[model samples]
Target: MYCDVTKEQDIGSLVQSTIRLHGRLGIMFCNAGVLSQSMKTILEFDLSSYEKFFAVNVGEVAASIEYAGQAMVKANSRGSIICKASIAAGLASDRNTDYVMSKSLVVALMRCASSQLAPHVIHVKIISPGPVATSALCATLGMGADDIESMFLRMFRLKNDGVLKVKHVADAAVFLATNSANSPMSNKLEGKVAIVTGGASGIGEATARHFAVHGIRMMVIADIQDELGQKVMESIGSHKCSYKHCDVADEEQVKNLVHSTVQNHGRLDIMFSNAGIVSNTTQTILELDFAEFDRIFAVNARGMGACVKHAARAMVELKIRGSIVCTASTSASSGSERFTDYCVSKHALVGLVNRQANSLGCMGLGLKGVTLDTKHIADAVLFLASQDSDLITGHDLVVDAGFLVR
Candidate 1:
């Protein structure tokens, strides 16, 4: 589709033309983006540079999506519309403050739009990529191909020589637009919703009880242990908490749990994927059993990933910037020895935070804490869910009593 995402006249006309030409709109790619003059950091860049950056990068995208969404609704097509975002907001770089800030704003915009547009059966999504090998990017960096390739490999976890192409972006957009995907509506988080991934005990149980007292309306208490999970929910009272058997290690059940939580609660807002198992003894990688190592990684690393992925998907469908608190540990920073399994996974949890934080931050979402007290973490999440930490995103305040600092 011919789209000029910035100009009101152009956007209006593009939507009008789409209806005239195709009679129906299946998807909208709100993909027009730009960057600003590169600089060392936030301090080096002036306010005017940022203003220009946001104008071209963020304001234009929001305006375009707003215009396109109205057209899609008028055509009566439940379509998936994806926007382009960047991972720079999460990862620190040597320069380009304006670009990073602008990208961060896009994520917040997508999130807010996700909430506003979902009622019309329109899905708002964001495709965030790390560094890509685009000629435009190399030109922007003003560096040779070899130097750029080396830098990218050193900086990013997923490093490829290929410049991030427009097609790579297009492919991601296509996936979100597929009609066969039965994504839960983004508006499902507007009202009260209950969630308890590891609600049977520890931090999960504590968070559950805190939310319960504050008025959660409906809840689904999920845990691997049937009796404990059920009993915890029952203790919380049937009117507020209901138990579900979930082992986040199983990807299939993770999907089922999220769907079931949204179904049971009629809405979902708070998700605490706080379930994790730590090895009692500290063993080096060579000393630990493959089985034992796998067990901890299963529940702590991949398990948390599954829970966040599904919960985030549901939250996006509901058009809500829900609070997600993964149970990372003090060991994440200190590098505990015998606890190699725990340390590795907890460290990786921070990586997950950085990735999604950039996307969500642009959408006015905030992530808080790394290893605070259970009650403190609960309060922090609840505080973030409120208006307190609106500007705080992509941050993990380590509550290890200065262990990491030392």
Candidate 2:
């Protein structure tokens, strides 16, 4: 249980013991790492410290992945392998050169590992958190969590002071473990521009407002409801957000929307494809309306694909490695008595996201659903690990008590 990752034998024994106990490894989370106490800049970088840092950060992580991945492959057990990376490395910083370089290498290592292990159906994912008030970070800075968070707000000039939390990081890990998806999150949302489809109301509107609070420089609300979308944009501040009329079901409109945003903003960083609608009818197999089904798919499935395709093209063409998020329902994970059209379209959306993630390393989160409380999530995971959900993989069962609907 208590093993130094720096030791290969320790890692090997740990994996062996884990398999012995659990019969198979379901998840391997390589989260252990040491931060740079010296906070050395590139000018003052030292090789001796770099070696020590590399041993733990890069080397240890590689070892853990190898041991865990091998065990999973040998057992034919498909599982999730997650690693913790930092934004200080990703975004670049003036300090912590050794830490930064080590994390960068870790990213490269996991990327190769992701490709290599994909054949085995193993999900290798990275979570690049901006600044978490971890106990280690607090102790390193000799500051408390509140003080650290305050410092981050002032230092990063963050609009949302509550940007990073331990629970937030833990929640991301849970999603990756359950659904094989994660996001590259940063504390600073400043200077970022986004486009949110269906931003007129509901979850889309709420997320748009939150993005504004978190310091998005500009965001375009694309929706068919011109009046409501304009109202939400005005409420969030027109200087930061603007409303545009674009039906995602229309490929030309989606294409124009993405290209116009990039042309106007100079760069598009986040694409939140949240446009979708449920059928008025029950939509079960027996009474399924092909017309209604096509309508829903046009918006939710084909429309989402168009958004992702154009957004990715704009990002790649401009050489901007941006993030795209698709709003999918938990219903995608399972079948129900009704809303089959809505559920199938969501499944298509999920498939699109997962495909892009594998091929392009897209910044997407698998938020199938979770309850308002942590205990409910733990119970869900427990059931997932049990025989009840043995057939499930890449599934995010919504444990929310009808909150997603209500």
Candidate 3:
């Protein structure tokens, strides 16, 4: 049953009614939200008008979870509650400040709940879908049928050899509700340190903030761009977060950065090898300039290799088993026709993940590969970094909307 999540009394009444009807709450789907249409940019936004959006989109969802989750805990039942989130949580598209801010807060709030509630037996999850053809989205965006279809197609990265529908999320929710143990926790990886390279902008920045929001005390943001790196550090605040400047392609700099992180952060927990350069050329492989290929490889391939090398060494020396996640791309699997240099570099990254996973497996450390969705990659990194995947090592977490199989 769905109820307006914003009203505390309404949420409380809904919980009371659900328990009364079903004897106990089997699951909770915290999915009430509002989208901004007319007020697209922050400059155009009225604070009072936008406050309603936050209340409905984020606040209500959190309140529902708090009330519903406490009920589930009291019942001592195994349950998984899923929340509706969006890729907007990561990407800052033009003219969507209010929507993006609300979605981003939803992610942060859900992560906080996940950590606090995990010990009790209630599982909290967020499903971040890309542009879906929902009536609400269409109405808000004021797009016609053709515009709607085109928007969906542009974001659908996966080959359209198959049909995708909203029912996919519905089915996933059903599974989370019925499953006995969706994410059973072991005490591993608790209180571990993490390093997020390039943790200053784009996907890296989002992932770093996500991890920090999840109670990772020590996070080292290694980036060559000092200004942006420092900005991220400031934005996340300096509790256990610190910034370091390092050209990942240089062996000495990589080594020094890892050393300082270990010295200061105490122990390594998760290594997010996410920094990479995109080639300026958008040409076919045969026509692409050789210099473009070298430039991309130096950063995407050699840079990643250097990161893995030093981070793994620190983990091994400290005798701390940790998970290392490298950012690969969907372009790695197929030719991006226009982005040949970048494509080949991404392909090489997959090879790096495989080889490093094999190499680190012998040392009791874990290596996981991740492909990017320009949005879900941050969430995927959080999933890998969390305590849920203790046994998942040397595996590729493809976040490309199912492109590998397609």
* Global lDDT of model 2: 0.74
* Tens digit per residue, CA lDDT, model 3, 1-406: 5566677888999998989988998678877777886546766777887888888988888888888888988889766778988878988777778888989988888777877777776777776755666778778778765577676556543221112346655644554455312334333334768888888799899888777766677789989889999989988988868999988878888888888887886778788999998877678967979887888888898888888888888888888667888888888876676988888888888887766675576575767788876475765777666644444455566655334333
Q: For residues 253-273, what per-residue lDDT tens digits would candidate 1 score against the true structure?
A: 989988987876665676777
lDDT of 2 by residue, 1-406 (tens): 8999888899999999988997899899999999997977888878987898888999888998999999999999878899998866566677888888889988888878887887787878877776779999999999999998888767653211234678767766776687321223323457877888898997678777767765678999999999999899889988999999999999999999998998899998777777888887886898889999999999989998898888878877776645566666667765579998988888877776655553443222221222121223433432332222222223334444333332
In model 3, which regions exceed 4 Å deviation? Answer: 1-190, 403-406
Q: Model 2, residue 351: what's the lDDT?
A: 75
**What's the true lDDT of residue 158 in model 1?**
33
How many backbone collisions does model 3 have?
A: 1
List candidate 1 stretches off by more than 4 Å: 1-191, 362-369, 373-375
Quantify all predictions' global Cα lDDT against the true fold.
0.69, 0.74, 0.75
Residue 31 CA displacement from its true place in model 2, Å = 0.2
For model 2 the TM-score comes to 0.51
- Preferred candidate (lDDT higher): 1 or 3: 3
Best by lDDT: 3
Residue 403, model 2: lDDT of 34
